[model samples]
Target: MTATPDIVPPTEVRMAEIVFPNHTNHMGTLFGGQALAWMDKAAFLAAARYSRRAVVTARSDQVDFKLPISVGQMVETVGRIVEVGRSSMKVEVELIAEDLHTGERKLCTRGHFVMIALDENHHPTAVPALPADIAGP
Candidate 1:
């Protein structure tokens, strides 16, 4: 039998946004809702890239706000697929805040999102399995 080609894991997705006055709350920090929105967008992008299909957020879990991100800070969100099921992928996302002037960075928020791939009819569809090497025992 011929050997199967190795399946490469999808690359992690990273997106950056600058915190502006409009994005902050009265306390001058990033709004919790805005942070969650950004995190969900990152998760969507990562899942779409991995499946090469349309995806939607099924649920979000374990969201934690660890720090306050002040206005004028750069926010970087990173998303990676942590687990895979028949039609769903679990994406772990982290939002980091960086001070432009001081070059200091802190993880402001983290969460897990479940995304499901969709077919042409917008129904759930099967996704590729994680590679043996990437899916640890």
Candidate 2:
């Protein structure tokens, strides 16, 4: 039998955005809603990369804001597929806030998102199965 493919988390997807005044709340911290939106986008990218098809957010698991991301910080989001099913993928996304000047990074938030692959007709479809051997936590 042919060997199955393998995937890893670190190389799955990487997304980054600079936090601006508009993305923050009155307290000068990144808005929770904005962080969720960014995480969703990162998850979508990871799902699409894993399945090689169009995907949509099905549901999101618990999200925790560990720390505040202040304005002018660089928000880096990393996403990878943690679980794969027939048509759905569970992706975990972590947000890191970096001090633009000092290059210090800290975990700001983390979340898990589920995405469903879609066919051309806009209906849910099967996605490629994960290989038996893969790397990543």
Looking at model 1, the pairs that clash are none
lDDT of 1 by residue, 1-137 (tens): 99999657584799999999999999999999999999999999999999999999999999999999999999999999988999999999999999999899999899999999999999999999976666757
Which candidate number would show the highest TM-score if scored against the true structure? 1
The TM-score values for the models, in the order shown, are 0.92, 0.88
Deviation from native of the Cα of residue 53 in model 2, angstroms? 1.2
Q: Give the Cα lDDT of each candidate.
A: 0.94, 0.88
True-structure RMSD, every candidate = 3.1, 3.7
List candidate 1 segments past 4 Å from native: 1-9
Model 1 error, position 69 (Å):
0.7
